[model samples]
Target: MQRIVLERAGGTPVTKRAHLGAVASGNLEVLCEPPAGDGATIVVSTSVDGYEPVWRATLERFLEQHFIAAAIEINDFGATPAMVSLRLEQALELAR
Candidate 1:
């Protein structure tokens, strides 16, 4: 049998952009910046009103789980949890 590679080699990091996604209906915008200290900082602002706590909790948990180290600002329109997670991943990937 041939050798198998479980993980690919790492590449040079990229300087991340400031914004991501859209600010329209069913879409959201994410702005990321370098962290001031250790962990990451996530801020969420919604268009349709309320749900601040939910958004905060979800984003906080996502950052914690991923061990991300950046300051992220999310302008949410109406994205689902799954969508938020996926978008966050994408944003971070692009960040790298």
Candidate 2:
């Protein structure tokens, strides 16, 4: 397993919590909640190792567009970048 952490600044705070998707083969899950501090903190645990760059890129792009301040957890099981982005968006939508 690989763990990745990302911190981003300047975003609208998320008021509600949300959970979306599932951590199964070729899939992943997202858990989002109000931030513990200002900005956003994202923690990812993936079954596939050595994919930190990919995970970072995918998350940075999403955050750049959405700009939401929340604590996000992503549990991944061999999920693709597209799926990751989709799940993040869904979770953010539900959270907002």
Q: Using TM-score as the measure, which candidate wins?
A: 2
lDDT of 1 by residue, 6-84 (tens): 1112223235766678977778888776665545656667766665566666676665556556767787788787778
Model 2, 1-96: lDDT tens per residue?
989999998799999999988989989989999998899999999999988888889999998898789999999999999999989888988999
Q: Per-residue error at 42 for model 1, in Å? A: 1.2
Q: List the residue pairs that clash in candidate 2.
A: none
Question: Model 2, residue 46: displacement in angstroms?
Answer: 0.3
- Per-model TM-score, in order, reads 0.70, 0.96
lDDT of all the models against the reference?
0.64, 0.92
User: Of the candidates shown, which would achieve the greatest lDDT relative to the real structure?
Assistant: 2
Model 1, C-alpha of 35: deviation from truth (Å) = 1.9
The superposed Cα distance between candidate 2 and the true structure at residue 60, in angstroms, equals: 0.5
| Candidate 1 worst ten-residue window by lDDT | 1-10
